[model samples]
Target: MNDQHIVKSYDRDLEAIQATILKMGGLVEDAILLGSEALTARDIEAAERVRKGDKAIDALEEQINEEVARTIALRAPVSRDLRILLSVLRLAASLERIGDYAKNMAKRVTVLADTRGIEGADASLRRMAREVQGMLRDTLDAFVRRDAELAREVLARDESVDQMYNALFREILTFMLEDPRTITPAMHLHFIAKNLERMGDLVTNMAEQVIYFVTGEKPQEDRPKGDRTAYMGAP
Candidate 1:
């Protein structure tokens, strides 16, 4: 009713939205950890839990979208406030996609568990997944702290994830060539590696959003990429 009351109401709405974002982020982070654990341990039950947990992440994304829209219509936020809401929307979308990648990784576990395990492949993938999970955590922290430098650090880490995938790609290729029997499992392993690489990229996207939110400008430097599987193909 009064101007003071309106300001307090808007503040409450913004806080609520941020709290939801963190809640959703926590779920995604857990999914990443659990999904990678399932893969490395060859635990089908853990993988199933990751798959079922995705439904909650999806619901949170929808809720964030609705709340953001409602906030915009009711409060008519301006300037930095609007920027934050917009950033939250983008962050939610990125987190949702990361969740999907995690879910996809879990889906492959069933097949991988049934087939013979590729030597060292799950270990490499789990390591990559762990790195991505760390990046995601840092990006969320950056968002909360409004730390552009930390977000940039998260972006820089993406190259390591790509390099890990490249290394695994060559290893799998060699395995396939060395033994015909390994081709099926190697292909599945490659897919999981690709999925983890993608999750890293999505985390980088989230980091970029944090940078933009803090500075109001996207980073000018080109993101370095190390994925080289395409070049290794038969010519």
Candidate 2:
């Protein structure tokens, strides 16, 4: 009876940790969407709100790490339980990075607000951000369901995000080359696009962690990357 009670207690602790992670994921999703919307609308107040909300996301991550550490110390979880806790750390890290990228995107809205608008560039970036946000939503779902197949599906979708980034990169480059006046805003838009692309990559990493947690093996195939703008020193 005592052992059963202990097991149940550990399970409860794990559930709490998972709950915190989901909460953090929710904040990250909001950041991504809100940041993009603010950029598209050129709403400085909305962008500032997105930036401010990042503190909550960061707080949740810190809370999760502390909870995980406590659980590990008290429960001494082994095998699959240990794997789940470790994967939670990785997922939290990825989510935090995605949040930071969203903040970075929001930070640029003010700078671009003053520069001459690049035709359709903001709209294109919003679409790209939307794609990444969708992927992150599905990745979180996969993590909760412990659905490796769903996670793998999310992994496959990242290539589409990369392709979107590639297209945006070329479009922005064309604008920069055609009008010297567009160089400043176009460059900021490109940075925003790159941030979105990196967010996609981070979402994929989270999806991969989900797959690993479920299957006990990482996917053997190389992740398909569609971003081809690296030749011009684009990071």
- What is the overall TM-score of model 2 with all chains considered together? 0.96
Q: Per-residue CA lDDT of candidate 1, range 39-93, in tens?
A: 8888899999999999999999999999999999999989988998999999999
Report the C-alpha lDDT of model 2 over 1-235, residue by residue, as the tens digit: 5989989999999889989999999999999999999998889999999999999999999999999999999999999999999999999999999999999999998998898888888778888888999999999999988999998898888888888888889888888888899998888899999999999999999998999999999755665566778765532
- The residue ranges of model 2 lying beyond 4 angstroms of the native Cα positions read 232-235
- What clash count goes with each model? 0, 0
In candidate 2, list every pair of residues with a backbone clash: none
Error of 2 at 232 (Å): 5.1
State in Å the error of residue 158, model 2: 0.4
Kindly report the root-mean-square deviation of model 2 from the true structure over all alpha carbons: 1.9
Error of 2 at 184 (Å): 0.6
